[model samples]
Structure formats: C-alpha cells, structure tokens
Target: MATITLTVNQAIRELSDIDPTTPLLWVLRDHLGLVGTKFGCGKGLCGSCTVHLEGVAVRSCTMPLASVAGRSVTTIEGLAGEGDELHPLQESWIEQDVPQCGYCQAGQIMSAAALLNGNAKPSDDDIDTAMSGNICRCGTYQRIRKAIRAAAEKGGAA
Candidate 1:
C-alpha cells in the first residue's frame, strides 16, 4: 500500500494505504465516488474512462494510482461552469442533442474538452482526429462533431 496525493477537479485529495497497481478508474469510482467517469472496456482500447492527467487526456483504467502522484486530474463531474450555468460544451451538447445512451458522454465530453483547450477553432478533420479514440456505441459521431463546432463558434470555452 502507498499513500498518494493528487489534485482532482481542482481539489487536493490525499489517499492513504492503497495498492499502487490499482487502476485509477477504481480509485475515482470506488474510493472518491466520482462515478461520472464510466467503466467501458476496463482497458486502454476504450476511452470511456478518459480523464485529464495534468490537462492531457488519458485512459484512467490503465493508469495506476502511483503514476498520478502530483498531477491534476479532471473528471466529467469537474468539467462544468462555476455553478448551474452549464459549460459551453455541455450546453451545446444538449442543444445539438448529442447523447444517445449517455454511457459514453462523459468520455466524449472529456475528450472534447481537451481538444478545445488546445484547438479552440478545430476543423472537422481536427475533431475527427482528436475524438477518434473514444468509442460511442450509439454512433453519434456526426452530432458530436456538430456540437463541438457549435461550442467553439459560440465562445463556449474561454
């Protein structure tokens, strides 16, 4: 067991006595109770467990708690406006009707947020390339792309 400290959703968390090899997905969902990050393949192939490791998108299921020692992690629950205002992407997602089953939405949103952070005015190809890893069984790719573009244009993210 190892003690690890990390910044999650801008809050510092100190976890004492935990297996280092345990996947971050379990730590977030099981320990911290941040269930927004879904469990999909439980492997690196699926991006359902995507989260931001120091502002970079990564698969939490394959990442061990030991590796994220002092990094800032952002989950779906953390990606939003200050309060009930709703993030631009969140609003655009709803406006565009981007969710089907909603199982993959958290990963989708996390991936999209990363993309927008780097490239605010991403083209269709950029969106395609950045979001390619996330798999949505509902196949709402077109709508997802549209919502991203809309959010970018509407100044949804600063």
Candidate 2:
C-alpha cells in the first residue's frame, strides 16, 4: 500500500494506503465517490468507463491507479462548466434526445467532449470515427452524431 496524488477535475486529490495496481475505475467510483464513470464489461473494450486523462479519452477500468499518479483525470462530473452550467454538448444532447437508457451517456458524452476539444468542426466521418469506441445499446448513434454537429455549431468545441 502506498500514497498517490493526482489532479481530478481540476482539484488535487491524494489517495493514501491503497494498492497502486488497482484499476482507476474502482478508485473513482468506490474511493473517490465519483460514480459518473460507470463500470461495464470490466474489460477495456466497452467505453462505459471512458474518462479524460490529460484531455484525452481513456478507459478507466483497465487503467491502473499508478499510471494516473501525477496526471490529470476528468470524469463526467467535471464535464460541466463553472456553476454547474451544462456544456454545450450536453445541451445539444437534450435537444437532440440523445439518450434512451442513459447508462452509456456519460461515457459517450466524455468521448464526444474529447473529440470536440480537438476538432471544433468535425465531419460526419470524424464523428463516427471518434465515437466508434463507445457503444449505445439503445442504438442512438444518429442522435449522437446530430448532437455533436449541433454542439460544434454552437462553438462547443471552442
């Protein structure tokens, strides 16, 4: 057991006396009380555990706590702007009716946020490629794409 420190959602967090090899998913969900990053397919294949590591999308389930030491991590809870203002993509999501079951929406939104961070105006192909890793059993791919495009138009990427 050891201590590890990292930035989470712009806040410095220190985890003590924990196994460094533990998956970051557990640390975020169980230890840190951030349940927005869900658990699905324990393996890294499913994007349900997606979060941002240094502004890049990553699967928290397979990412070791040690790997995130001294790194910046962003979970769905941090996706919103200050004062709990919804990110543009989030507003677009509601406008587009993107979620059905909503179980996968957080990860889906996180992945979309990363894409928008890099490409303010992404093509349909780009959206498809960036979102291919995430799976929505509700089959809301079309809505997802539309939401991304709408958010881009609203300067969500900026």
Candidate 3:
C-alpha cells in the first residue's frame, strides 16, 4: 500500500495508505467522500461510475487507483460553475427535464461533457454513439439528447 495524491476538482487530494489495486470509483466515493460518481455495476459496462481523468471520461469502476496517481479527476460535483452557479449542461438538463429517477443523470451528464469537449456540435448519431454506454433506466434519453444540444447551442463544453 502506498499513499497516492491526485488532483480532484482542481484541488490536490491525498489518499493515505490505500490498496494499489483499488478501483478509482471506491477511492473517489468511499475514500475521498466524493459520492457523485455512483456505482451501478462492478464491471465497466455501465457508465454510472464515469469520471474525467485528465479531461477524458473513463469508467472509474474498472480503473485502478494506481493508474490515476498524478492525473486530474473530475466528478459531477466538479462540473458546477465556481461559487454555486450551475454548468450550462446542468442548466440545460433541468430546462429539458432530463432526469426521472436522477440516479443515472450524473454519469449521463459527465459522458455528455466529454462528448462536448471533443465535439461541440455533435449530430444525433454522434450523441448516440457517445452516450451509448450511459444507461438510464427511466428512459430519459430523448431529453438527454435534447439537453446536450441545448447546452452546445449556448457554448457549453466547447
């Protein structure tokens, strides 16, 4: 076991004496008190545990903490604007009524953010391809797509 320090939400977080093979999802949620990244499946199939590792969205459940020693991690809580303002994507989410159960929305948003970071104006197929891994049991996909477009229109994640 070794101490790992990582940049999370623009702040340096030191994790003390953790197992090297521990999943980054647990490290974020259980160790660092960052529960915004949920655990839907222990496997990497579901996107519920998505987080940005140096601006690229990754499935935290399958990612070892040792792989993220010096990388910057961005969770749902980090998406908010400074000083309590909501991200444009988040605002668009509420405006488009994207969440039903709300359990999967955070991962959905994070995935969308990664998509937007790469392609600001993604087509329907693009959105579909990017968000395919993020499953929402409530079936709010149409709203999720709509919200992504709305956020892009307003210069979000661009």
Candidate 4:
C-alpha cells in the first residue's frame, strides 16, 4: 500500500494506503466514487473505462494507481464546463443524439476530445483511426463520427 497524490478534475487528491497495482478504474469507481467512467471489459481492449491523463485518452482499467501518482486525471463528469453550459463535445453529442444505451459515450467523447485537441479539423479516416479502439455496442458509429465532426466545427476542444 502506498499513498498516491493525483490531480482529479483540477483538484489535488491524496489517496492513502491503496494497492499500487490496482486498476485505476476500480480506484475511480470504488475509492473516489467517480462512476462516470464505466466498466465494460476488465481487459484493456474496451474503451469504456477511458479517461484523460494530462489530456491523453487512456484505458483506466489497465492503468495502475501508482503509475498515476502526481498526474492529472480527468473523468467524464469533470469534462463538462461549470454551470448549465456543457462541454462542446457534450453539446454536439446531444445535438447529434449520439448515444443509444449511453454506456460507451463517455469514453467515446473522451477519445474524441483527444483527437480534436490534436486535430481540430479531422477527416473521417482520422476519426476512425483514433476511435477504432473505442467500441460502441449501440452501433452509433455514424452518429459518433458526425458528432465528432460537429464538435470540431464548433471548436469543441479548442
């Protein structure tokens, strides 16, 4: 057990006496009580537990808590801007009606955020390449792509 300190949603968090090797997904959901990051497969193949580590999208299920010590982690709940105004991606998602079951949307949005951050104007192939790892069971691929493009046009990540 080690005490790990990390920035979560712009706030510094000191995690005490936690198993170092424990997956960050479990730590976020169980310990920190941030349930927005879903659990699809415990394996790294699924993107359901995706989160941003210093603005890069990563699978939380495969990340060790110790590895994130002193790093900045952002979950879906923290992605939205304060007050009633939503993140541009979230707005585009709603405008595009991008979710079916909504389980995978958070991860999808996070991945899109990373993509748009790097490339504000991404082509379809670019989106496909970046989002290939995030599986949406709702089969909302077309809508997802459209929403991402819309977010880019709206300067979602910019």
**Number of clashing pairs per prediction, in order:** 0, 0, 0, 0
What is the C-alpha local distance difference test score of each model?
0.91, 0.94, 0.92, 0.91
How do these models rank on lDDT, best leading? 2, 3, 4, 1
Query: What's the TM for model 3?
Result: 0.97
lDDT tens digits, residue span 1-83, model 4: 88889999899988898889999999999999999999999898979999999999999999999899899999998988877
Candidate 2 accuracy as lDDT: 0.94
Location of the lowest summed lDDT over 10 successive residues in candidate 1: 79-88
Task: List per-candidate RMSD values in Å.
Answer: 0.9, 0.8, 0.9, 0.9
Task: Residues 1-158, candidate 1: write the lDDT tens digits.
Answer: 98999999999999999998889999999999999999999978879999988778899999999999898999989888687777789999999999999999999989998998888899899999989999999999999999999999987563
Q: Alpha carbon lDDT of residue 42, candidate 1?
A: 90
Could you tell me the TM-score of candidate 4?
0.97
Candidate 3 vs candidate 4: which has greater lDDT? 3
Q: Write down the lDDT that model 4 would get.
A: 0.91
Of candidate 4, the 10-residue stretch with the lowest lDDT total is 149-158
Most lDDT-accurate candidate: 2
TM-score of each: 0.97, 0.98, 0.97, 0.97
